[model samples]
Target: MRGEELQELTLEELQHLERTLDVGLSRVIERKEQQIMERLNGLEQKGMQLLETNKKLREKVEELAEKQAVTDHPENVFNEDAHSSESGSLDCDDTSDTSLKLG
Candidate 1:
């Protein structure tokens, strides 16, 4: 039918047309919402994976720092002469002269 002819419908017919349009629009909105939720779920999964990878890298960095501290010690680089006042030299200050008897 022509546009003018369809516009000239009675109020009851117009109400029926409005109800049909509402049903179709509601379905379209529902599908759009479902698609957005699926994309959000995928992003959350990727974020979790990134967090796990960051944690592993942090652990590796800590391990390397410990190894470097042992290999390149401060005493070796400074080249300060160490004098022994107590027997069985331990990593302690002169205030505490007690030696630990380690087997």
Candidate 2:
């Protein structure tokens, strides 16, 4: 079948050999296609899993940010009010000190 001693093969024998080779080639091609499809399916599943994980992580980050904002908002307001009151008292003290110095 490798072109060696092919002169000895009759037309019928060559035809049979050709048919056998064609059947073997078809099986090989079919198996290869099946394996490719399986690999593609595996990769697709992995991609979907990664997407789900990413979505969960994004949601967790957003939740944490919201919690942080809620917790920080009150502190910010408290600090501002505290600073304003302190500054107001300081201003009163400064005015009294200035009046005493002038007198």
Best by lDDT: 2
TM-score of each: 0.59, 0.63
Reference-based lDDT, each prediction: 0.77, 0.78
After superposition, which runs of candidate 1 have C-alpha atoms over 4 Å from their true positions? 1-6, 74-103
Candidate 2, residue 58: CA error in Å? 0.6
lDDT of 1: 0.77
Clashes of each: 0, 0
lDDT of 2 by residue, 6-29 (tens): 788899999998899899889999
Which one is best on TM-score?
2
lDDT tens readout by residue for model 1, 1-103? 1235676689999888778888988999999999999999999999999999999999999999987977865543322356445545545457844655556
Angstrom error of the Cα, residue 64, model 1: value is 1.6
